[model samples]
Target: MDIRQRLATNLRRLRLEKGWSQEEFADQAGIHRTYVSDIERGARNPTITVVERLARPLGMSPSELLA
Candidate 1:
């Protein structure tokens, strides 16, 4: 899969593994729920800053998620 797809898949997996709903994940990441949904659906190309914000709460690094 492409990077966007991979990112979405990984994000969903991590969130589910932590028993978090989209809203919960979004809150923890300090982002809007709609934006989180867009990311999870692979409909948005997040900037580096956004990626870092997401990765921090997911207990991962931006590079790790990108990889």
Candidate 2:
């Protein structure tokens, strides 16, 4: 899969592993729920800063998310 798809898949897997719904994950990630949904759907191209924001609560690096 492409990088965006990889990111989406990894993000969803990690979030589910943490037992956090999109809204809960978004709250922890300090972003909007819809933004989390967009990322999980591979429908958004988030910035590096945003990726960092996403990675933090998941105990991951941005590269890990993209990997």
Candidate 3:
């Protein structure tokens, strides 16, 4: 898959593993719930910094999220 798709898949998988809904995951990631939904849907092209923020709560690195 493409990087966006990879990120979306990984993000969703990790979030599910943590038992957090999209809203809960967004709260933990310090981003908007809609943004999280967008990312999970591969509908947003977030910056590297935002990727880092998303990864932080899941104990991952941005690269992991994009992998």
Candidate 4:
């Protein structure tokens, strides 16, 4: 999968693994819920800073999240 697809899959997996709703995950990640939805749908090209924000609450690095 490409990076967008990778991010969507990984983000969904991570969020579900944490038993968090998109809204809940977004709140934790300090981003808007719609942004989380867009990311999960592979429709958003999040910036590195946004990736870092998403990663931090998940206890992972941005690179790891991309991986």
Give the candidate number with the greatest TM-score: 4
Clash pairs for candidate 2: none
What pairs collide in candidate 4? none
Residue 40 of model 1 has an lDDT of: 91
Per-model TM against the reference: 0.95, 0.95, 0.96, 0.97
Question: For candidate 4, lDDT tens digit of each residue in 1-67?
Answer: 8998998899999999999999999999889999999999999999999999999989999999999
Runs with alpha carbons beyond 4 Å of true place in candidate 2 = none
> Which has the greatest lDDT?
4
Computed on alpha carbons, the lDDT of every model, listed in order, comes to 0.93, 0.93, 0.93, 0.94
Q: Supply the global lDDT for candidate 2.
A: 0.93
Candidate 4 regions off by >4 Å? Answer: none
Looking at candidate 4, the ten consecutive residues that score lowest on lDDT are 1-10
Per-residue CA lDDT of candidate 3, range 10-64, in tens?
Answer: 9999899989999999999899999999999999999999999999999978887
- Per-residue error at 32 for model 4, in Å? 0.5
Each model's total of backbone clashes:
0, 0, 0, 0
Greater-TM-score candidate between 2 and 3: 3
